[model samples]
Every structure is written in structure tokens, then in C-alpha cells.
Target: MSILKLKPSCKDYLWGGSRLIKEYGKEYEGEVLAETWELSCHPDGPSVIRNGAYAGKTLPEYISGEGRQVLGTHCRRFRDFPILTKFIDARDNLSIQVHPDNRYALKNEGQYGKTEMWYVMDAGKDAFLYYGFQREITKEEFAQRIREDTLLEVLNAVPVQKGDVLFIESGTIHAIGKDILIAEIQQNSNVTYRVYDYGRVGKDGKKRDLHIEKALAVTNRIPIVRKNSSYPHAADCDYFTVDKLNLDGRVMQKLSGKVSEESFASILILDGEGTISDEREELAYHKGDSFFLSAGSGTYTIEGSCDALVTTIREKAAQVRIGIDIGGADTRIGLVDVHQKLIAWKTVRTNAMRPAKEVIQEIGQTALSLLEEQGIAMEQCVGAGIGVPGTVDRKNGVVRYSNNIKWEDVDIAKEMGACLPIPIYIANDADCAALGEAAAGAGRGCEDVILFTLGTGVGGGVILDGSIYEGSGISGSELGHMVIVENGEPCTCGRRGCLEAYVSVPALIREALAAAGKELTPEEIFAAAKEDPVVKEVVDTYIRRLGTGIVNAVNIFRPRLVILGGRISEQGDVLIKPLEEQLRQGCFGGEKSGIPEIRTAVLGSHAGMIGAASLI
Candidate 1:
């Protein structure tokens, strides 16, 4: 049903009050009812589904049972459920603490970051709380205060009443005051760096440990001037957006809303009793109750006398990306959306003789034309990605060198950004092609992948854990340059016996010309190699060299997939079979370590463009 009511997980901390039992109808039989995790998916204290097809199940179980789409499109960007809601009844003041941002928390705590908003449901007459530093303080002074038990003097003490809102962003030191009941909407992360605990002993009769060093590293030791942002939102941050819902049963008995595919809706009822209904079913709700509505569930009505906080994810106008493929002769531009759909496409002739600035300008104009044709606004565009055929300084978005396009040390992204006015990402054409395969072609569903591109010259891309591996200094993954023979053949890279010298299409055609005494295309060479003994020897040597290279890559990276792309890949099983046998014979662990599956890329020529677009 639409209204999936939840049963909160209760905590019985030492400073908790029984107000949750006397007022909020909490059925907990513990010594204290400190906090109620009303809408939680964390493993430590998961909320239970009270009414639905998946009744009596944990929130995580319900999520798994209903597909991740239930969390909505915005949530899909997160690896786990994005938000957590809870009710806190603090009988005593909480310890002064701060939380880390995503980068710090993810590295140290192995979880997402915390940025929370608190709504004062009720508070004592003289209740007050710490907001942040009253004024700018030196790190040394802040540390000294904590050591001397004078931290409260530097903290900003603000008196609070019912219906007050305080946004506690990550790194802002804050604490809840005694005799305060609050409804908190926060990120899923539970990392907190406690600086002080008022010398209060825990159940084991020892003071709560202080993460002083960690707190110093993360805390914002400065006065916090709350911004009165008029975005028509209570808390409109990256993690979540919350809006207050005050319904009067006497006048308006029902509050209707629509949850689009963009975000799931959550209702945390703080007061009153009522029933939420939709086309599916009706659910009764009370104080301290929580309801989860899946995304794209269409229209729904909340019919009740209640005070609630409605939460949903706020998103950009669109998640579309601009993809550019800088080819030697023709450059292609495309617009790809979050759904991986190529919504708009265009192509322009590239005058390599023109200045790089003029050429880049023309490419940017072509992208705008595609958007106009599709009736898409530039504001809806996320970012732009360009794939250039050469070594690229991906970080600087500069094309270091491209033999195919005759470009060297060109700041492609900087020039394009002048017109596009969005973030620009640049990557090597081969790496982009490999990304395309991993995302939508043969390498899909695999994390680690190695792509061998055997065209005029052999080049490859190494993908580690779904991202391009540039190795040290953004100049690595030159797999085709690995020498397979001791001074056997000269290579374009000015090296002797390189794998590219033997396995590349140009190399094969040259070998066939020497043996068959006729210049021919790779296809014609392959056909002749099947009949002529002299041509067969050259073909066998080519395959054997390629097999050696493939085996070496497998043994080193141990990728889950090894894709063969370029013109040679068109042969499919003809090349894959012999390569597989050769790997089995020579590779140290191709079979025992589970030989990486060999597959031909499915996206073909468009792979470069598609992969570039995904950079957004």
C-alpha cells in the first residue's frame, strides 16, 4: 500500500526521559526512552514496517522487497537509503559534538556524512541549546576550553521554544539542551566527534570518551550566522529537504500531495491522529508515527489532524550530460540523460588545420544546436565530457597528445567551458570507449575491466572498480606498448617488439603483404591467411603475440572482463577462441584464478561518445 507505517526502534540512554512513554505513546519497556528512530534503515537500529504487504519487516527488508526505485531517482545517486528521522527526548543536556563531512566521514568512519535539522516539538520554559561558537576562536583556544571545562562559555547559547528550527550542518559544534523534545531529520551517517561530555559517567561508571583530536580536525571554530535563505524550504541541502505540515482537522481535514519519480516522500507525524489514504489503501497515523511513500506513487491524501514534517529530495532541473567525441575528421556531440538515453545528437566536420580555439568553439556551438533541436534548455544540462584520441591530463582536462587528431598540449575543456559554462571533463578516446563498454555494452555488470583496442595501432583502457585507472601521474595504462618479443619488430612508439607491432591491424596487414606478396586490408589479409601457408604463419604469430599480451594483462590486473574492441574484435569467436586457448596454456592463473570472460564490445563506434557523456 502507499502508506507504509513504521514502528520506531527505541534507545534507553542514561539521560533519557519517560516522556516518550507518557506523551508519545511509545510502548518501550526499557529503563529510559531516549530516542525513537522513526524512519531508519541503519543496521544499528532499523525501524519496522507496521502496516503493508511487507508488515513486521525491517525498513531495510521492505526496501529490498520493494525495489530501490521506491527510494526515487534522486536517491539512486546514493549507495544506500539517504535519510534518517528520529524523535529525541533529552532529560539531560547532550554532550557538545560535531560531525564530519562526506569526504572525512567516508574515509574515517566508512559511512556517509551527517547534516541535521531539528524541529522543537516541545521545550521547558527556560530551555536553551548550544548552536555554535559565539565568536571566532583559535584552534588552540578551543582545545584549551575543552581541557579546562570552560567550553560552554565559548558556545553560543540560544533559548528555544516550541516550533523552533535549528539547522546543524556538518562541522558545526552543537548540542541539545535538557528538557527538550525534538524531531530530527538527518543524513544516514552516524559519525559524531564528541569534544566534551560534562564529566557524566556511563553505565560502567566511566566518563564518555572524547574524540578531541578528531573534533579539532573537523569542527568549524567560528561564529555561525544562520542564513535566512528564502528557498520556500526549511532544510534544502544536498542530503534532504524538509517542509513543515500543520493541518487543522476542523478546517482542512486533508492535505494532498504528489510524489513524482524524482523523490520519495516521508511523513513524520509529531502530533494528533489521522488516516493517510490513496488509491491503494488507508493507514491510521498517530503522534511519533512515520510513513514512507514510494516515489512516483502519484496523488495521495493525508486526512488527519496533525503536525508533521514532510521530506523529499530536491534535485537539479535535469541530469542530462553533454558528450563530445573529437575525431580526426568528424566530431560528434550528444546529450545523454541519467537514464542513459541519447536524447539529442549532432555531428560537425573538424578542420584540423584551424586553431584549437576555433575548433573547440565550433564543437560547443554544435552541442547547443543539438539541445535546441531537442527543445532542451541549457539550464537542464549537468556537465560536458569530451573524449580525445590521445593521452589526456584528465584532471586538467587537457589533451596531452593525440596522433589521430594531431593535437598536443591543447586545453580542450577550458576552451569549451568558455561557451558551455558548465563543468567539463576530458578523457582519452580509448578510455572513454572502455567506459562505454563497462556501462552499456559487453562489460556491463562487471567492475574491473580491461579493453584492448586493435585498430591502426593497439591501445587499451584499464578500468578499476568502475572508474578509469590512469595510474600514477595520470599517465599510465599503456598496455599495447608492453614488449612481447625481443627486438622482433619495430613499433610506431619507437620501440622494438611491442605487442602493438604484431597484434595491431596495421601490423597484421603489413605481415600479410610480406608473406602474400600483395598489399591488402585486414579483412582480405585474414581471408588469405586461411588458405596460404606463408600468410597462415604470419596470422598465427599475430594471434600468439596478442594472446601473450592478453594473458599478461589478466595476470597483472586480474580484471573480471577483458573486452576486445576495434576492427579486430569484429572477428568475435575467431579471435576469442585461440586467445582463450593460448591464455590457458601460458597464463599463470587464467584458469585457476577463473579466466576473465572475453567479450566483444556491443556499443561499437558510439561507445566513445556515450562514455564521455557519462562523465557528468
Candidate 2:
């Protein structure tokens, strides 16, 4: 089946204080404003009705009767469907604003608060966006400024490129400047409290009411400036994470892993063009394209020649510390600790997969000392797990083949066990991720789970009945090798139409370069996806294919839960909704009731390490 399609409705201005004609050109003049295009709610948008005899009816109307039977209470608001889509055109700058948390919004606005990202469509040179205030301003100080019309003095104005993307958390004070168009994907709510505006008149020639009291109540005093370059810095927060991608040359970048349960990714291609390949399909993207890749145990790859931007979302932590030991070209080990709950150690060398004995020896000498200091004896340590970038025989603990690590048929677990006098586990990095989730993170407490990781190459892992499911000598669960399209694209696995052929990180980056007509990174592609529809189309196709693969997994396993991990998972709902929709449309079963609960993986990079530890 084809990907699920959402119908969008437009909103018209000329009412109350909302400006319409002036903000948008005559094409939107006297016409309805395009508020949202998805099947969810905006109060001003359209809804998706169930297909059948009542196909054209509103979702609400259909749900009131026969539709209720086909789609049960499992999805009262909407089954496997995303909640909303928002569109904004800044004629003049919007008032600096902020949204409250869900509880606060329900109490005050009788709706959900918005947590959203902006994908710039059209921007003038030197365009700007309001992210946070300049400094910590006391409520009294903000109140006085609001009364005197001097709020802009306290706000930070960051210049924007045409394809820039910025994440606006619930309490962030922000606004869009004039001559900019944005497609805003957010939670299903419209409870923005306007703190300040440029004193502009509406189409009705009346001043808009300022929500000074509410704005001051929710505004975060910390100042923030959206970075202007392709690769802007990232600031982790409890709600979400925002980062910029600037791709140059044929580069494949991996996100620095974090320890967090439930993360998502939003890839917005700011410029250039190329295709993002994953385990299942290939996504051709250009500018203004946004696609969501679920982060699980699977690794995905992207490739192209144009520049792009990518953003990842994951759990926030109090502190994240990393220990790096650069070992020339032999092997470099990186150790990461997050709030003491998670730890990840990685070894990279000029070769693809190191000899099992060599890896065991290095891990023992380097990481074991640190583990002992942490009260874990070499024997008390659960298991030592290793991830090679290439193929693996997880069941037999054999490194099948790794072009990067340069190893084949090496018994990793056996060799490690001999060295440490403890149980040792080994799998492809992606499979290790599946074990990680099952042992500690998102898939914890669930008997059956599936994980997909998005990176240079798509990787996958499955857990069934409380244990990692390695099929037929551990050759199974190679989800990245699955083919979603016939004769689609070439993959590193030496196969065409494989999932990695379309949705891998390298593939996504490549698509961004092609769109911009220059080389860039995944972060740059994300920025471009905000403003360029061509990029958006590429992302949309990628997202749809990703969803299709997920649906296929769901149909085959029908697991109780599905957790998305890795960097691509940072896209969050941008990828989740469409994928969920596809699953719903494809899955056939009894009662049309509760299927699998699909969520972002809670464990971030630590999943593999912890899972490996669990093996002890």
C-alpha cells in the first residue's frame, strides 16, 4: 500500500486581530489562511475521515458512529495518527511568545501547549528569529518593559539563513521576523502567549492584544540565540534537543550518543539534493524537506554531494561526560558516562573489525580499570560487548565481515571470555543496540521489542520473549538488509533495494548536497528542509519509506512494543506520525484494538554498552 496521506485545511484572516492579507501576498488575499495540512487538529484545520461509505465525513462525525467499530477506543482522539500541523507567515514579526506545559495549558488554555520547530521557507537576507530573551529578567522588570513597549530591548535577535531550523520548547520566548515563511510542526495546541511584537497593525487596522501576564508567567529568562551557520551548536534540554548540520564533501557523520530514554530526530534539508537510504527504501530529497528517522538498534546511511542540515532529539540529562583516548591509527577508544545510569565505550581503528583477541585485550586494559573503580570487578562485570561497523554473527559471537574494522570469522565473545574470565557478548553495533534496549532502556520491562538505528548504515535488532532474537545462526534480524523497493538503490551490504539504500545517515546527507547543488552535512539538510519544498519532498519520501519498513516489522512480529533509537529518532513525531499511520493501515488483526505501543527508545548510546554489561 502507498503511504498514508493527510488532508490540510487553510485558515483565512480578516477576523478579530489576526492579520492575513498583509502578511501573505494577494494569492492568499481574501482567501483562507493555510493553518495546517495534516489530518489532526488545529481548531482551524481539516481532519481525516475513515475510508469506506463514510469516507468524506469529518473524523469526529465518523467516529460518532460506524467508524467507531473499525477504529476502537485504542485511538479515541485518533488512532495511529499525528495530532497537528501548523503553518505561519510572518508579515511583521510575531510577538515574542512562549507556551506552557501540558498541565498548565489544560488548566489555562483548555488545550495542549506547543513544542515545535520552524522550517524556513522564504526569508529575506538578514532575516531573524526570536529564540530566547537576552538575559534573566525578573518578572517585575519584564512587566515594566511590557507596559512601556520596550520588550525588544531584552530579546536576542539571531540572523537566519533561508533554510535554517530552530526548535522552540514549551517555555521558550520566541517570534518569527518579517518576510519569512515557515511550516511549523507541533503538538496539537494553540496556546501561545505573546510577550512582544514590533507594534504592527493588523489587517483590520487594530492593535493585537498583548498577553503580558501570561507571557511573563511562562517565559524562560535564559537568553538563546539561534545559530546562523550550517552547523550550529546544540543545547540539550528536558523537552528536546536542537542542532544544525552543515555538510561538506562526501562525509558521513554520526551523532554523539547520549543516555536518555525516548529520543527522536527531525531531519530538515536546508539545501542541495540527494537521497537518504535506509534498510527498507530510498528517499530522494531536495530543499525544504523534513523527514523523521526512528532511532532504534538499526543503523541507516545517507549519501550525496550537496550540503544539508540534520537535527536530533533525545532525553536531556543533568550532565554528560566523555573520556577520549586518541590512539593514533591502531585503535581509539571513547568512553561516555551519563548521570551514572549509562556508560558507552567504543573502539575505532583504521581496520573495519579488529581481531577478537585484540579487541578483548584493549577493552580489558582500557575500560576494565574504569569499571573496577566504579565497584565492578572484572568477574562481577556482567559481559563485555563489542560493536563492529560491519556484518556480525551475533549468536556465535563472530565478526562475519567488517570492511572498516578489517576482521572476519573472529570469535569475539569467546576470545573476550578467555581474556576476562567473565561472560562476553558480541554483536554488530546495531544488534548491540537491540540488546541494550531490552536490558536497560526503552524496551526494558517489555518481552518483545524492535529497534532501528539511523547512521552511516542502517542497523537493526529484535528482542522476543525477554531475550535478543538471533535467528538461524544469528543471521536473522538484518533489518537494514530488507528491501522496501524493487531495484531502488545500491547499499553497502552489496545489495540493491535494501533499507540502508535509502534512509542511512550518509544517504540523507547526500540528498541534501544534491538539493543545494553543493556538499553539506545532515544538519545543513535539516535547515534547508524548513524553507525548500523540493527538499521537503525528498524528506517526505524518505519518511514514508521509513514508515513502511516499520510497518513491515510490526506486521511480521506484532511485538508488544516498538522503540526507535539512534540519531534519526531525534526527528520525533515528524517521522512517528506517518510511520504510525502506515502501520495502522497495513496491520490486519483481531478486534482492531491495541496494537504495539510505538515510542522513542529511552536508552540512548548506553543501550549497547549496558546490554553488553547485562550479558554478565
Question: Against the true structure, whose TM-score is highest?
Answer: 1
| Tens digits of lDDT, candidate 2, 1-616 | 0111223354643221223234422123334352434334344555543234445655444434533333222122211222344456565566667888554564466445667777775677878987788788888988898889888888778787765677777788887887676656565566778766567556678877778777777777877655554233443333334565554444543222321123324455545566666555666655434444333314445455444334343332333222222122444333333323454455545332445566556655565455545544222232344555566776566878766656667776666544443334555566666766776677777878888887767778888887667666655578878899898888887778888888888778776667657766665666667888888777887787787788788778778777777677777777787777777777667328447777887766556555544432
Cα lDDT tens digits, model 1, 1-616, are 6668888999988888999998989889885899999999988899998875788999899888888788887764554688899999999999989998765664466565688999999999999999999999999999899889999999999899998888998889999999999999998877889888888999999998899998999899889997656258777776789998888998978889998998999999999998888888887888888889989999888887999999998786457788888888888888888776677688888878888899998898788777778877554566788988878999788888877777889998788866675568888888888887888778888889999999988888889998998877766588889999998799988989999999998899888888778888877767777788887788788888899999998888889889999998888787899988887787675467787778988887778888898765
Q: Which stretches in model 1 have alpha-carbon errors above 4 Å?
A: 228-231, 316-453, 456-510, 516-616
| Best lDDT among the predictions, by candidate number | 1
lDDT for model 2 comes to: 0.58
TM-score of 1: 0.61
Q: How accurate locally, in lDDT, is each candidate?
A: 0.85, 0.58
Model 2 ranges off by over 4 Å: 1-356, 394-396, 590-593
lDDT of 2 at 86: 45
